[model samples]
Target: MADTEVQFMDPLASHSVVPSGQQKQVRGEREPDRTESLQNTGQGEVEELLLSSSAVVAQAPPCGDRAACSCLGARWMERSLESMELQLQLLTSKADDLHNWVASGQDHFEREALAEAVSRFLYNCQPYFNHLEYLRSHKSQHTLLPLDSYTWLVDFSQQLCDRLEQLVLTYASYNLLCLDETKPNSVSPFCMGQSQLGPLRVAAFRYFKPMPYLAQVHTGLYKRMRWNVARLREEQREEGKNERVGDTEYYFLCYEDIPNADAGGDGNAVRTWSIGKWVQVTPGTDDIYDWIMCEVPQADYRRLLFLGSDEPSSSSATVRLQQMLSSHQTAE
Candidate 1:
């Protein structure tokens, strides 16, 4: 204590006099880093949380009440059915108009108009037919609809099919329609003729094998023609035997190419064959002929064959035809 001047040191003074950089380092040490804290929380946990949220959202229904959702669905279906019914009614009216027009024996121009209208009707009806077919294939959906509604839809579709088929045949009977292979789907009169020639011939050929003929000088020349004529004659004779008037008739349109036969044999020659009678042949060019098979056969076997072959066998339309036939049978 001799001459010390009573000097006193504070311990906290040294701690408070730290450099700015050192102060920052000391504070950083005391506080945890945000990045490090997040790192400590595992990525798996974050992903699990996101997944759980998504699951909750997915599990939630469109409506809070189950019955409410069902009611909404039923209402939508009812509206769809109503709209479909309207379409059916409109188409039926058009079909009736077409029937009247055909019965009137209108001129060529009128026939052309009717043919275009028919093509359009068939094209338009395809969507509805497809929808009905969908309902038919899916039992659950079909059952969900009201019984009366489903029945009515099926019945209307069948009736529409019958009407359209008849109209096409009636139009073809005029022999005014010609085939233009280039435009199969065109609404023109030429393409409309396809509705009669294409499906019916394909169905008939597939169902009934070509009949055999005796060997002749021009065997290969008229092979198809001979077979077609023979089959048609046989079918017509069978129908006549039962004393039932046949609904279908076959007409051959040909152009002869003989070196010296009746001066080129009327390029647009058309001949209608009678029951059990063979078509007259000039023996010029047998393959240069087109057949117009008019009116659908009324027999069940023939009808089913025609329906099944209305489209390509592998097509959805064929399936629809089968379903329609099945439904028709059930109804009957």
Candidate 2:
């Protein structure tokens, strides 16, 4: 969706050419030269290969509708998704280890060591291009995270990208496009004036994983994109049950800017968005980051995105969101 274009190389362009001198010709009998015959055969083979590859590429539709995609494309997608699943398992294991360590009442030195281990894992687990591409295409599918556990990996990696600052713009642009695509009655703000942010931005903002608890989220529900609302609150309740034991359901607020109807103008304007709290909130800590509270209508979700300008802090966003929730409960 980003204006950036990717040029793909022809799969058969680098086919090996057999040397002309490698083929020998018989001395007599008026038979066709062996070398010529071999060359002709090779040329025909190359043409066939090229034609096959081109046909696959030409016929392949967007991955969103994988059921109708070419067999070759579907195979690649399956491979990519399988690889991602393996990688996700590794990440989840690492996060669980970290949580267990915290729960064990380790000393300060031990805690530091675990933190360092997490840093190493995060760096090593950075997704490959194929994995990222699959994620890009499979954004709307609920099949990826069937159980909705350990989705914080995406958020954690996204937060790391924000701190690194490299490739931020590229990610941002992609995220903007994805956000629009997922939104209901979505508007194309990037075309009107929004700048592109690349993959990191896209991952941090647009990517949605299912909540770890029961009950479906209403916003963007038609697209089958789940947020962490139900499970986040569930985690909050669980946190209260066991104070000392370290569990993974820590919560933090995150805010993103999205397109909204302009009050007095024809053009789209940015709106602040605070979904449910981000995962991995520190134990025994209250109100660590800034946030605000608000209710997002399912019908308007297409216009909503995860990245934008002039957003409020987590605390501010949390407060606003709380107010909205309370008011909505009262109205109901």
For candidate 1, the per-residue lDDT at 214 reads 22
Candidate 1 residue lDDT tens string, 94-178: 6676667767887655555555545444444444454443333332333344556555545656566656556666665665332
How displaced is residue 4 in candidate 1, in Å?
99
Which candidate gets the maximum TM-score versus the true structure? Answer: 1
Q: Residues 1-332, candidate 2, lDDT per residue (tens digit)?
A: 11121122233443233222222333434424532332232234334434443443344345564444444454544444454444444445445544555456665444434433333332233322213432433432333332222233233334333332222222233332123333432221111000111111111122222222212343322221221122223444444321222222212233333446555655565644434433222222333232122122111233323323544432233234434444555776
TM-score, every prediction? 0.36, 0.28
User: Looking at model 1, which ten-residue stretch has the lowest summed lDDT?
Assistant: 1-10
Error of 1 at 155 (Å): 1.6
**How much does each candidate deviate from the true structure in C-alpha RMSD?**
34.4, 24.9
The segments of candidate 1 whose C-alpha lies over 4 angstroms from its true place after superposition are 1-66, 134-139, 142-144, 177-332
